[model samples]
Target: MTRSELVTALAQRFPQLQTNDTGLSVNVILERMAEALTHGDRIEKRGFGSFKINFRLPRTGRNPKTGQCVQVPAKAVPHFKPGKELRDRVG
Candidate 1:
């Protein structure tokens, strides 16, 4: 679900939590996750998945539109690996 939907669901499930509080909670969690990823840290949630940064070396790529060769710069991208429990549940 979208972030807003998650907030609404949390608020509904916990009557004590206001929508605003739930929204803030979700924002804090997401911000922390992003911060960790930015620092190249790994985050693992049991029964869910793990998040890490993967490095891509610079390489050449073809431009599909013009069939021209282009240089691709290296970059660090976020990657996720589902845990066994999550894989089984989803499957």
Candidate 2:
């Protein structure tokens, strides 16, 4: 689901919280996660999953369209590994 859907669901689940408050809560949670990722920190939520950064080395890749060699720059990407609880639930 999208961000707005999550906000709506959170607001519904916690009737004591206002929509604006719920929105802020959701935004804060997302912002914190982003900040952690930006610092190369890993996040692990019990029964959910773990998020970490993976580094890809620069490499030469072939262009499928023109069959020409291309240089691909190195980059750090986010990776997610599901927890056992989540995997079990899905399975």
Candidate 3:
């Protein structure tokens, strides 16, 4: 579900929590996760998954538009691996 949908679900699940508070909490959690990734830190939620960064080496690539050769710079990308529990549940 989308972010807003998540907030709504949380609010409903925890009747004691206000919708605004739920939304803020969700935003904070997501922001922190993003911050951790940017700092090259790994985040893990046991039954959910893990988030980490993967580095890509610089290489030559072709532009799909014209098939022109281009130099691609090295970059760090966020990657997620599902936990065994989550994998089994999804499967």
lDDT score for candidate 2 against the true structure = 0.97
RMSD of 1: 0.6
Candidate 3 structure quality by residue, lDDT tens digits, 39-84: 9999999999999999999999999999999999999999999999
List ranges where model 2 is wrong by over 4 Å: none
Model 1: how far residue 8 lies from native, Å: 0.6
Alpha carbon lDDT at 72, candidate 3: 100
Candidates by lDDT, descending order: 3, 1, 2
- For 1-91, candidate 2 gives per-residue lDDT tens digits of 9999999999999999999999999999999999999999999999999999999999999999999999999999999999999999999
Q: On lDDT, who's better, 1 or 2?
A: 1
Off by over 4 Å in 1: none
lDDT of 1 by residue, 1-91 (tens): 9999999999999999889999999999999999999999999999899999999999999999999999999999999999999999899
Could you give me the TM-score of model 1 versus the true structure? 0.97
